[model samples]
Target: MTDPSRRRVVVGVDGSTESRTALRLAVDEARYRNCLLQIVRSVEMYEENPESEELDSAVAFVRDDLGFTEVSGLVTSGFPAMALLEQAADAELVVVGSRPRSAIASVVLGSVGSAVATHAPCPVIVARTSGERATPGARVVVGVDGSDVSERAVDFAFGEASHRGTGLVAVHCWQVDHPAAARWDAEAFATRRNEHLRWMSESLAGFQDKYPEVQVTTSLLEGRPAVLLTELSRGAGLVVVGSRGRGGLVGMLLGSVSQSLLHHAYCSIAVVRPVVPSS
Candidate 1:
């Protein structure tokens, strides 16, 4: 196991505009986590691997210009995804950059960012918001459905809110039969909504107690999970979600429902994975 004191926040940088964005976020993340920052640049093994001016210069800039001397850089002989996973074996988090249009599409098409997010040992944040960048005070939104995976997501969301000192939005969405398919009375309809709301509230009660300082808003809406979540988090800095959900906002990071928000949400998204245990 890696030494706990040497915890690192890793990012893949290839001198692209997106990679630069990832590097910047990684720098802030490392500082926030009080850990080291690592930037990995990958080149094919068959290529001339030695003496990359790009990597050297980028590293120099991160160290000198950025005033982040605790940052380190690595040039590896492999695909970028493989390099990121190798470095993230013991990392606290791995950050990858992508444009909003390409964020999850690249993942579906088996891009490096998707590959790393799916397989990274730690949480992976794709720094692609519809906006120019994420703001510090923006609330952190989380999608929940009361499943074990969503529970884990809530755990991470609470920690994020507590640390960032931002409000947390926990959204749970469910749809009754379509209006055309079922005719219901106002009282019955209201009763069903109340049941769902109560359950959603209970799902978050434990987290609420644990993070008393985190102001949380529970969104129990009757609509498509992805649509509601996307609209709710329009102004959020980061929308966190479980890799899978219990028929809620996120089904699978690569699934249709999750892809909707991945396609439209205007904020950075963090795909939280199961915490990797230390040996």
Candidate 2:
């Protein structure tokens, strides 16, 4: 049994392929953080409920097969996202999986992953399984735009990099809105790149001392931030980006850049929202 006082990694599973992937990643996260793992499956009213056997088997796999000691499971009644949000109010991290879908399916079926990432009080990771970025040198890549939420993302990314004993890559993108309107100057381009490099380094200033073991690098690319990040994700163990907290319909509709990365990034994506004061 996990202590109630300890901050835990919470993951919701529904016996789907996506949830299973989320569970595995959650286990690894729990192990590294030295915290509890709470596996939850919510059975909404009038809907067919998941078998308790599946939850038991998952808990067993973590304890017996995976040999992770600090783990537990719960089967509750409610909307899946609401149930998860309630449990994750004080969690260290809340994880959910993105549905594998075509572009249209993504719009039609608003993502639970996206929902939780937006409204959860803590940072949320929309975990996915990809082998391309799981190499020995794989780094935790973070998008840095200097927003408060992006700074929080930098903190989460540095912690993740330290936990994995890996490197970190801070990526920032700057592009001229319209090429035709602006005259292209190579010298000006170099100066802009150098400025972004310094800005990225400044973003890491606070966290570098906290995680000195992590080898960090900055990538200042000239392109769309979303597109560059998606391409970078192909070689990173994890890609972390920031999303602002907005309630209601606006919250449900993910921002354009995050929407693009969530759908196209090759590695697991973590959408971190800054922690807001309750008072």
Candidate 3:
């Protein structure tokens, strides 16, 4: 049973290498936040020793090997994505792993990672590699597009940066199709570029004030948002983006840029949805 008194970090465990990676990250994060790590696995309940064996060993690994005492695990019955979502309702964060997909899906988030990232109640971190760990004082990057969802992402990024004692890179990317346009419509292009820079500044100003210790930097680039962020992810400890963005149509849950980063980011990616208030 989940102890409601203790804050929890939820993770999906499938006894795969990727799941083990997710478990490691969850343990690290839960320890950092002083929260409980709840590892949940989905099974039909009739499976024999290997399933039980894996779960038992995973628990022991967390307790005896990892030395995290506040660890508990359970086997629930349902599909992987749905079961994980049900377990994550009260969790502070949901962590999941992504396997390398085929060439096409490689450019987008995998099926399970996509579903959970879009619908999880809280922020979701999609772990891409088994060994990419955020080092001390590493940088967290977030893309802002002047939307409500982007605002939430910025807030989450600031908090994460502060928690990790790292810096925040707030990136805003704008596109100019041709170099000739810059030479031909110089003033217009300059004005538009200035506008983008101002928007990035305004978006980060309040966060900077609130998280005074988190060193914040701004990246205003004239390129595709997804491409720029992908390049930026090479040096980032974590890359964050909104579930849906200014380019997405109404009611769309995930944006193209966010989806792209989930597949291509070098480090962990956090997909944050805007909180909806209750009635």
Assess every candidate by TM-score. Answer: 0.83, 0.87, 0.87
Model 3 weakest lDDT span, ten residues long: 100-109
- Highest lDDT model number: 3
Candidate 1 least-lDDT 10 residues: 248-257
Candidate 3, position 12, lDDT: 84
lDDT of 3 by residue, 1-279 (tens): 556698888988878877887888889889777788888877765366577677778888898988987888777766778888897788888999876433554644456788899788788998766234556677999998898889999999998888888889999887776778786998988888898888778878888899899999898887788889988887577899998888665345778898888877778889988766676
TM-score of 1: 0.83
lDDT of 2 by residue, 142-203 (tens): 98887777788888999999988899998887776555544567666566668778877876
Q: Looking at candidate 3, what is the lDDT of residue 155? A: 90
Residue 227 in candidate 1, Cα distance off native in Å: 2.3
lDDT of 1 at 37: 85
Q: Each candidate: what lDDT?
A: 0.76, 0.78, 0.81
Displacement of residue 80 (Cα, Å) in model 2 is 1.1
